[model samples]
Target: MSGSPAARASNATDHDAEQLRALGYSSNFDRSMSLWENFSLGFTYLSPVVGVYTLFGLCLAAGGPPMFWSYLLIGLGQLLVCLVFGEVVSQFPISGGVYPWARRLVGKRWAWMVGWVYAWALCATIAGVAIGAGPYLAAMLGFAPSSNANIYIALVLILLSTGLNLVGTKLLARVAMFGFLCELVGAILVGGYLLIFERHQQFSVLFDTFDININGSYLPAFLAASLAGLFQYYGFEACGDVAEETPNPGKRIPKAMRMTIYIGGAAAMFACLALILAVPDMAKVIAGEDTDPVSTILANAFGPVGSRLVMAVVMVSFISCVLSLQAAASRLLFAYARDEMIVGSSLLKRLSANQVPSIALIVSGVVPALIVCLGLFMADAVATIVGFAAIGIYVAFQLIVIGALIARAKGWRPSGQYTLGAWGLLVNIAALAYGLGAIVNMVWPRMPDAAWYINYSMILTTVVVMGAGLLYMLLAKPYDKGTAPAGDAWELSRSGSHATGRATSQGFQQAQ
Candidate 1:
């Protein structure tokens, strides 16, 4: 603590590494990312432009103007979840996010299931975010936006993002920061223009449902439309996913997580509000006649050339989102493989000269590409695909929340730079309740007249993914092979030292 400023910073990094070692891991990642870069990663993953633009048409059709409120509702709920994650990551500060936190908080088996669900969810999210960019690219290029064309474009984006991700962690952080700036500034400029010069509706219009109702009541459709918000609010957890790569992660990552929710949520709501107020034909959108309301609104607000310029910015945001998602997924794979929990552990755990998970990145891109190919057989199912991704993540999140609750019940108190203290239990409980309710709202079958798979896509996909993981875990017993410490055993030895801001080799060995 009594060194030059540079040496002090180096000592802090050493302390971060020591904390990881105490948790039974030596630092494998580069650990060069700053707090800003880490937050950029989370912000880009939460990409407001990507979320609002992709879901605006669907939400408008399903719940009319009132659907805009979903952003506020879900933002508040996810804030609670983010708080719980902040405390978890601050204490554990490991890579693989929810999985490691669950492992440390509960047991190896429970963490394996969380990792299994989280990995697939991230892959699905990669496909969904990449595919969502296709139509925008098509429109900007003046190409006929057919299923084949969109598929081709989506594949191109996936490959492009994957290549960028494999280059290096520094490049990834730079691109994410650039994308965050571009997307946020573009959203503000475009949304501000629409609100100032192209407003076509009153503020009161948000409360008007335009007579949209389900079963003689509007509550059901409102709940269904909440998917718009639910999808937009996540990706904050990506901050913790790369905890190993960020210096002082136990302190920095939590602040980055909160900033992500605050800035990302506000930007999403601002863009959504401006678009809703500027909609040239709300009735047309709500009636399902205007399938591409976002394009229509932008074209009406800005001329064709200007709209194309804006679409280009949107493309960057989408690619950045894909890049972040791919990085996160590959890290989870690397974490799993490092613990010898997955099938191709030797390969997936290997790091390149750049300290990047090159092979894991390739697998991450491949899985999402496979999911994108499904677009050919099932057209216009982007919403369904993204819905499943949301549910998978939410379910995994709740697993961590439950694990933390159980750990608390057994006398586990967080002793990190970030802790909730007396509010920890209450916040964790609220997060669990909100997560459960959101899962129900998202997984409920709303398309009864459609094909059964289409109607129950989220539920079916979740069950299949989880069911497969369970079968494999039972048959293979991967949890038994894990040699790392788990179930908060480190706390019993190091909790006092952690509170005193001292992590010694003795504490690390004792925890082991």
Candidate 2:
């Protein structure tokens, strides 16, 4: 096989040695994360938020008792997209993840558009996740009177996570593993308690009733609710962004993604079910004074002390989610920088001694921190950010699945160990259908109320952001075509290139 276009370009460079040194191509990032670490990263990536359950309640509020079925339906829809992602990651396990795959499958211009949008979405998501960490932490510490302090706490959390990522991927993986374990134990313990003590509530209520009186159609309401539930499944792609740092990335990246989805999805499903069952009355629970469902459930199950303990667990889970998001967002920034797609390519390409993208990490963290502060001025700030982040993620997913289909149609078979086989076509179709449906639901007008107005603001904000991306593409079209060398070994390996002085070997043999 021929070498990557970037490698060929590098070979023809007048300053070849200097270019290689600057790009950190000579340094190795072949660290092996254990299966446990992989699983933990995935789990923590979907941490428990009061808002997550509250969003489900909103779904229940909007779609009635059939919300549980909506969760399952959305889960199935996401599974199809996950399969598409699984195929791509297995075939091209590079740090750029969807960006590079889109490029190869659809050409550089379209890839640039997708990468730019994904990078922005990632940054926005980091801010949204960071903002989420604050309320949970404040709730745990009984800091209700000083709700404003949550922003300060969020800043601190962002800085701490940024520091951890700067230390190295190995350390990040270790932290993720610890967080994941805590989430698992906490989920199981809480879930088991709910199952044993709270089974008196009719399970049939969670699945049967559909009495919401929204102005929208039931299908649209279900889609809206599903989008909210679907947000819980957003972080599995984090594994793909860090593919370059993993051992045997082509194989392990895909495995990690698949397991992340299955394990995390299953855990979330159980947690949601337990929360539903624990509620004394669905209508009363929806109208309850307590805004935080997990705390409320625990307070009922084991009194105030138990509620505080659950709050503490939730705080840790939020921190873990923020950390994972920070790490993943920085990787996306790094990839965009390496490809000259972002504004400051030179700064983003700088790596620390530990091979971490230090500059990118700081900038990515800081930018979102600033954006999240906007929440201080708006009542529904958190909801708006969540909605915007969700839209950004869905757009990226659409681009990736479309790219995968195009690649498959052109006979671009992946030689990796984890192939998606004949299911790829079906998966792409289902994912596209789900994605389009969710987008429509999110933008549909709701009943004239405070919540509807808030939803409208979020929808408008998302539309503006997307429009801005389109504008950026138009103005930046000329610059987007300037190709830079793919900056890491995983990318080079995918393109059939070896580092200088490395022997020419097929597949993963060179690294091994």
Candidate 3:
């Protein structure tokens, strides 16, 4: 490769091909998603409206008005995580966001575990998000919301999203763009109206944590409040999950990820603050009353018609979120299946005429439906499943972050256009620390009055999911025991070695 124009283009193409070849596949995706479309995918997945509207009441209940600070704190922490992820995705820019990043930075088995947790998380997120939307959907359709009814409605929503995912990327992109607009614009208009025209509490309420009922302890209440940020900031990695379909992925994916967090965080905080500030009775809220502050505030600020209108917009955002999560999950399945990793690899890796992963789509779609159906019987099952979705994604994130720090200690360096460079170590360590702390917060036993198992449900569910993943990897050994790569993609792209013209032949080398 020389300094010629054609040489640069050839080098870039070779880079893409080489990355795929190392992953044991040729290009199979459409790679037709524009920057805005890529941004929309992540934004819709993050879906400020989805996260905020779902957990706002719980967050408000946890710590009263001071919960707004939790969102602020969570945003900063997730920004750090996103920064670390940006550097990783900038280097890999592959499908299966956490899996590929960990695979390359760590090793195959490690990455398999990453994919394991992430895939389940994505599937569960699909279920959790759909079921969470049931009440709004039920209200919209004039159906009495019940556990059984919610299950049926959630399954129907899942079916719609699954079909939407299978249509075509072009159509998917159009819908995602629409969701992005509706969520961002709707959040601004609704929050502004609630804050300005229908304010019940003054701005000083945000600083008041006195009335919060964390058994008279501030730390526990703050930690509980942190759940909002925890749930809201993730799903931005949906950008990196679709990197293969993105043009100029190395440059664009990182930006898309950061934008997803920044923009989504803004919408979530504004809406949450508006609702918090508009609550008229803090003591009643803390006294096990006004359980549905989100819906209550919307209804208070805007009458039934206006609240229903907003609920309708939220419904659209929920469907959009489901569509994005399923799309991302299908890609995870497809990415692993391309290497014959999963149980139905051959089928899952098969592409439809539209160039989408056909069987993977079915797996991603149907599994969540089955999971959400559990809501019909199990007491508090939906609540626990929703908790799983939030914590599961966070666990997947930390796996990659942990792997990055390990790789860094062993001389791994950023090989992409975007990198933290001299500050990479500091950022990675801080992000890792934040992740570990957050994980503890998530797993902490908050339900003191409940049974032991029920109180530790999140920890138990996470363990079961991870245990299943580890067991599958131990038995399946998904990585091909191959030695044909001239040099591993990491080596090819990790430094200037691609230009050195050394070891471009065919010899396999593992990342570790």
Candidate 4:
């Protein structure tokens, strides 16, 4: 393997392919996504612009300016989750983020349930982001932000993303990279301008709750407002979702995951802070009068033409987010189908001539579009769907964390390039606790006067998705259809080192 540089590179790729074969899967993806591209995919999925803009108004109205602090809290918690996930993906760089990781760590039935919950969560997220962008899209085009317009615009964005996804993986990576750059720059420029030129509120206003409380307590309001922060911190797991399309995934994917949290979290925090401090009328916004505070803030700070331009940037962030979410969801579907762990395995697993999961991508697009259509019947659809998405994602994540802890108790140790060593247990426990707390906060009934379904949407949606999955697993037993091997594919040595550690290390070095 120690020859010319080109020879070394070829050897590294060959080793990666061999490792996939060892896992009982064929390498059909392009494997052309570089480490930067991988990071970009996760970054754009997190999409600070989209998350902060969409949730800022709702959070402000629910819990006052202090709710912004949830960003830091959720960021720290999600970073711990990212660390545990880094360890898992390093050992098992499977295509689907949570599904294959759960399958290998636990068993078929458990993984199936996790995948089902996660896939629907991704769809809900896709629809949520697209719908969030509708207002901005309407602003850019000088159209009214009505329910029908939002639905139609959301569908258009989904269709556009699916078409881009069908083209190939390289283009996906490039577009993600472009989106990341645009979002980062836009956030910096817009936030910087607002902070320097349009700041009105004192810095101490963040600690002021404005006496917004529910049921003789502000706790519920703050917890409900936590949704804003929780939604911003996910999508880093998208790094692991495209493991098959990435080179040296065991080493690079972990780094990409961590970077996604650090960078994306910082950007989201800065942007949210800028918007919060620069709002033209905080009292009006918190009083539930300024429904679109993002637009209001931008208009006041940047004038009409500049606001529209920034709105266009926001639209890019949304579209990029949808693109990344669709990619992750389709990859999960492809992985499940590849393992024959879902219905319509043969069709969903098929790769086009371009080596992309075209049919699965279409399904991904179609499902989210349908979800967007459902928004037409519901008031505050973005908020409801976002709550559902956040809860489902947390539950799915906890399943993996729980599975890993169970595996560890049975004497399994992570032996990949990234290992938590003796701290794995503590970190895993912390991640699980944080995830569980977030889920509870997300599902807690807050809107007492609203419809029962709206008030309990988060809990209800989780029950429906998980209950449906459980029933399907019991009746269909789709996991029994695949011959794919499960459980740990890599062997550990007497000293607790991976048997393929040398090859993996060399491959990563060659890739470097």
Candidate 5:
């Protein structure tokens, strides 16, 4: 039986190789991504999702009028983390991102554990995007009441996203760029419309505090309220996942990371401010009474047609977000599989002729499909999945920040272009604090009859998922020694004599 299992593994590897050859990708597929394309893709990853106005109501529900302060705090915290990511990504611009950095900073064993955890985190994120995409699409179609229909709609969106990714990276990048443009235009229009027509609420209202009964503790209430706000800043480091495909990744990756942070951050803050000013009664909006705060605000400012237009724009933005996330998550899975960290490692590593991680893309699509199917068992599955996914992502973010701190302590700094200066230490400390706080808020237990039992499920599932990674490390540590460092493996594949493995354009050489 052992021999049979070994034979099956060999067959799988051979099949993966055959798929890569058919896809027209050389073994050095990692070198195909250009710096500009990488930056553009990264920008899209952070841009479209800035429309958190609809969900802002939930934050208000959690924290009352003081939710704005939570947004500011979370934004500042994420900026610190982004600074850390900028420093690390600029130094080691490999595809594995945190996993590779963790390996170099700590030891290979710890690195594998980090990589496995990070990969699963990204996988959960992709599932959340898929689940979220359904409702956004359903709203656009005017199907507001049917929960089951929305699940099917979400599954269809996931499938379509998979098809686009499987087609090629160039196509994916082009679509992402277009989506970025739509997000930019939509933000400007929405903000301007609100400013011109409905600028009544004072800025001071944002900082004003109000008390609520939340299991009898104000602090817990505040934390719960801030959790929703914190979710808005979750994907800033997404660019790091695609480092392998990025040209001059060392510089471009950091630039993209920082730009996304500042641009997306500023845009979201302004949009939220505009939203607050436009609404006459923030309390009514926060009480879970308004079904569509964004559309209502726009409709009040403009008209029914105007509201539809804004919804259309928001739908486009959500689509762009889904597309960008799908690409990022698939690449992450491909990177892990290339390192043989997963069960079907060889298959997951397959690349299309266009240098896209086609097999991984298909695998990612399957995950969301399964999650959508779970909707059949419960109406709140989407919310649960998203919360669980967010927890996974936050956990990975904490690990990466911890890894970055270790690297800094060891006097390992990336030279040239985006260094964090003397403030690197300070930024790391702030990021660590922010990450830990967010994790705590996300997992803090709620009352038995709370609206979201999914939060508890998320906490439990994240623990199990992470535990699986530890188990994998214990079982696979012996074989991992034979695999070359990610940097070296990338370099060898690019320089080798294989016809498809030759490097094309180059400015900054990869670490290998």
Candidate 6:
């Protein structure tokens, strides 16, 4: 039958290569992931249940009931960012989301810097997500939430995701699909049940200002709460990261990016609303009486049995987040490596017997595992690294947005199934503004009592990431593989230390 497994596999691989050629590149990896899998990768990366669940308590503690509204604002802002990404990825459709887009649209050096920062951001995000899972695991399993336990669990979680990715894209796709069902359905059901039968407060309660701000100004308090939402919406660009392994990536990847924001954004908003409204006592929740307010809400709304059941789904969401995170990180590595843009490009691009970038996959896991190990001794490591994630990703996204704007201003137009038409400039401007605003808000320092590093952690960490990237660019000074001379290979010029090669085949002419 045409639908037989073997036949489908052959068709998929052929289609994938054909699509890659149409986008001005040749396929080097197995295209085992279906469109559903593509969508799932983004969805799980933007895993609403995991994002909202992890951030809910922190937002509540920071701004009391008013914190949830930031989700709405950030959701709308990030959607603009996603659309800009959609437009750009529609035109590029390269494996590395930011690197290829920036290289082609901006310049080679700019692309290298963006890729360096984004690569670390992705890795840090995986570690941050894993570390965030420890507390929930502790609450559900009766552990003490010790540093050692968190470190071990985070390491185990990263390894599990790494193993799944190493197997093949097909299995990863299947697991991601399963996770999509559990997290999305679990979110809807959990939210609906609480909204229908368990709400202790009215919808109006969210508008109330508890005046929890010690400085007497609500602005800072609300801004503090906004970080929670800001952190939740990134990683959707992950669809573009796996574009090489996806069939018809040009059109499908953009759609998946938007759909991830749409569905996951809705799920996060609804779930947070449910938890806020279902609080048995708002006074106690706001007064820090319920240390684990989210868990308390779930446990109170539904009995222990139901709460644990939902926690099980949350656990799945956490693993799914890590899987999607590591998978995207590996693709970013492979993409940059294949272009010979990084140190050890030859080794990093080597594929396994299964046609996967095995070294990239393992490197992706190892770096995050080390980050997790750092969390073992530093309890505050989770917040700082996640701060890096929350701020770092938005910065990476805005770099691309700025590049796209510069391209458009210089007469670049998108050629794809998705285009903004007359509103292209307008949308791009909005995206840039939103991205810049979010970054400032997240990076703006507030704590003056604590040490400099702790108070300005986000800003300081971001500077460190960028400074390190600049240093690497100066030292490594990797070559730019313009176009292949004959095939998909860039023959290094037998010349000086810095060799820029020309295309070996016909496609977009390499700028030299």
Q: What does candidate 3's lDDT look like per residue over 438-501, in tens digits?
A: 9899888887788998879889889989998887678767665422221243454555553212
Rank ordering of all candidates by TM-score, starting from the highest: 4, 1, 3, 6, 2, 5
- Model 5, stretches more than 4 Å misplaced? 1-27, 30-37, 47-51, 210-220, 380-382, 446-455, 476-482, 486-512
User: Candidate 2's residue-wise lDDT over 115-211, tens digit each?
Assistant: 7677777777777666666666666676673435766787888888888888988898889988887787888888889989865467786765445
Task: Give all TM-scores, in the order shown.
Answer: 0.95, 0.85, 0.91, 0.95, 0.83, 0.90
Q: Could you tell which candidate, 1 or 2, scores higher by lDDT? A: 1
Over the stretch 37-115, how does candidate 1's per-residue lDDT look in tens digits? 9999999999999999998999989998899999999999999999999988888888889888898889999999999
Computed on alpha carbons, the lDDT of every model, listed in order, comes to: 0.87, 0.67, 0.80, 0.87, 0.65, 0.79
lDDT tens digits, residue span 459-496, model 6? 88889899988887777677445442211111111221
RMSD of each: 3.1, 6.5, 4.7, 2.1, 9.3, 6.1
Model 6 poorest ten-residue lDDT run: 497-506
lDDT of candidate model 5 versus the reference = 0.65
Question: For model 6, what is the error of residue 78's alpha carbon versus the real structure, in angstroms, after optimal superposition?
Answer: 1.2
TM-score for candidate 3: 0.91
| 1-512: candidate 4 lDDT, tens digit per residue | 36787776676788788767756678789989999899999999999998898888988998988988999999999998999999888888889899999987877888999999999999988987887777888898787888788888889999999999999999999999999999999999999999999998888989988888887898888887888998789988999999999977888899999999999999999998998899878899989899888888888887888999999898889888999999999999999999988878899999999899999999999998888887777657656666688788889999989988877876778877888899989999999999988887777777679999888888877888899889989998898998776655323433455634445666657654
lDDT of 5 at 220: 68
Residue pairs clashing, model 6: 483-503, 484-503, 484-504, 484-505, 485-503, 485-504, 485-505, 486-504
Candidate 5 residue pairs in clash (backbone atoms < 3 Å): 23-353, 24-353, 34-247
Query: Which residue runs of candidate 3 sit more than 4 Å off their true CA positions?
Result: 1-24, 213-216, 481-512
